[model samples]
Target chain A: MSAALEALQQRLGYRFQQASLLARALTHRSHGADHNERLEFLGDAVLNLTISRLLYDRFSGSDEGDLTRVRAHLVREESLHRVALALRLPEVLKLSEGEARGGGAQRPSILADATEALLGAVYLDGGDAAAHALVKQLFGELIDTTTIDNWRKDAKTELQELLQGKRLPVPSYRIVATHGQAHAQTFDVEAAVPALQLSSMGSGRSRRAAEQEAARQLLDKLRAPPAR
Target chain B: MSAALEALQQRLGYRFQQASLLARALTHRSHGADHNERLEFLGDAVLNLTISRLLYDRFSGSDEGDLTRVRAHLVREESLHRVALALRLPEVLKLSEGEARGGGAQRPSILADATEALLGAVYLDGGDAAAHALVKQLFGELIDTTTIDNWRKDAKTELQELLQGKRLPVPSYRIVATHGQAHAQTFDVEAAVPALQLSSMGSGRSRRAAEQEAARQLLDKLRAPPAR
Candidate 1:
């Protein structure tokens, strides 16, 4: 095995019985016919299950909705991308020349996919125990440092609670504009708190999502220190 | 244990070490403080992983996309509802009197959720081996009986292929209408095969999804036998 791969295994804290699985996991589809998409697909599920198990045990009192939200926050591309960067996946991923030129190695989606592929490979090579342990090693720290309250409430709810705590009137949301055809439309919403002269705009695939985005933006503005 | 519970165990082909877990899995939110939603959440992930693994093994030659489509079909609400019926979930699910009167037990979403909760309960009760074995017993026959061809191709591709097979002109898809605001738009698409004087309309969250639905409807119409 190459020194890089040997180092990767050491970092992963799990050795692959079949090194080829690890190699495939690090391969991008742009490289050749044999790639990591399948592994990524399988790995996504493995990661989800492992995370669900972790959250289930950690927040024993949390309801299913809160668990789902927290899990989503943890497994989203951004989180996985951070994990990939920590693991230095860019150094190991094999991408085609064009993809490399395009900075595919540093791309969040590619890195995240590779991370999942690696997890899948670990699962296939070392079974459930190894995969579970690997996931814990990769993500347990993030979950540990963050409080469940960070993700338990939706942005709108959190915004409302924050405003209520500060003796501020609730924000009002209005649909600013609609786009697309009858069946596939997007909502652009404006959230305004006239009392504080704060307003923000957000767009999403659903009215609720858009409202939440707007509320989130407003909350961020409220939380930020006043301009110097 | 109640006779009904005993019968359920016989059907599931696995016995829960903790009866409370099984009871919780069978209990809906409306039933009281204890419910199955948490178990359902965990079970959903377990089911996805199990199904993915199954497809990965069964269709070694299939690509990730094909594997995903097949897994989606197998684990969709409709599929789970069918499995729940086989397990007689409606006869055993614990729901409030109002929910019972409202037919909660037979509702597809409720039944499906219960099925997943049951799997989750099994996982918690007996570990991965028991959970995997239970899933195989519940869904193995469905997977074995169905061919990958049934779901490998998207509806649009399948429709196009069918038309081409008969030397018919390819279908044209046009956006009929769009609804909602800038963020959460839905698209209504009309798919037409002028050669066959057939057309269909379908709607979805995206144009591609709408077009596929339209194509699926057209395909169904074409596949129907000619009237006498």
Candidate 2:
């Protein structure tokens, strides 16, 4: 194995029994047919499972929605890219000459993919324990520093806060319809921001749940870039 | 443990060490404060990882895209609902009185969530080996019966087949733009079915990849319900 790979494994804190896996993990599709895409696919799943397990244990009181959001925040391309930079991935990634010239090594998507591919390679090389341990080493600090309270607020509270920050009147929510028998009714709620001329509808088993869903939808719209 | 739960464990081929986990897994939110959503979240990750690993091993020569499509077909809500029904989940699911009267036990979404919750419960109760074994027992047959040829076709071919099946003309593809240096250019392609007044665009590192993406987008539009 090359000195660079030896150093990378040391930094990753997991040595590969099969060195080829590490080499393949660093190879971009532009470089050759034997690249990291498959490993990336497998690694993405591994990363998700590991993170879910971590958050499940860490924030025992947090609900599924909060856990999902926090997981998303942690695994996004930008977050992965930051981790990749910390590991100095640009020095190791193998790209075609042209791609290299085009700065593929520094690309956020490529860096993020390589990170996942590395996890996948570790899993393939040393099994679940190795991969899980690697994930913790790479991500444990981030999780440790995360404040659950930031993500614990329900959708309605977040949406209201966002609108209030912009000096807009609070949105209004109303029950638009109810289906099924009273005991098992599904409520459909509509939330409208008159100042923004935006409206969204959501349905759930209870009025509050439906309103929260509607507010979440509206928040998504408000945060999204304007459509072309 | 209740006889019904004991029978479920027998059918699932894995008994829980902590029976309360099983009870909580069977409980829907409508039933009370303690519910299955959190477990469902964890189980969804377990299921995806297990299925991805299975496909990775089974289709040694298959590309990542093909593996992804096949896994999706295997783990979709409809597929989970089928497995849940086979396990006779409806007979054991805990639902609110109103939910039971409204047939919540047999609802596809509820059954599917319960199925995932059960897997999560198993993972917590018996660790990875037990959970892995349970997933294989439940889904191994489905994976074995799946013919890769159905999912092996590229998006363009699948779109062509769908259009031909409907007796419509084949779609046309054109390169709308190419960005970056020649050696590392990204292609943007547009695919259109003039007869249906439908079109979609996709961008990728190569023309073939871009066209496949465009076809996939068009296919998604064709299969989706009419927009509200």
Best by TM-score: 2
Tens digits of lDDT, candidate 1, A1-228? 999999999899999999999999999988876799999999999999999999999999987878999999999999999999998999999988878888989999999999999999999999999999999999999889878877767788888888899998888999999999988899999999999988999999999989988987897787553332
- Which regions of candidate 1 are displaced past 4 Å? A154-228, B154-228
Question: In candidate 2, what are the lDDT values of residues B141-161, reduced to their tens digit?
Answer: 999998786876689999999
CA lDDT, every model vs. true structure: 0.91, 0.91
The estimated TM-scores of all candidates read 0.71, 0.72
| Deviation (Å) of B114 in candidate 1 | 0.6
DockQ of all models, two decimals each: 0.22, 0.19
Where in model 2 is the C-alpha error above 4 Å? A152-154, A157-228, B153-228
Candidate 2 per-residue lDDT, tens place, A103-208, comes to: 9999999999999999999999998899999999999999999987666668898899999999999999999999999799999999999998999999999999
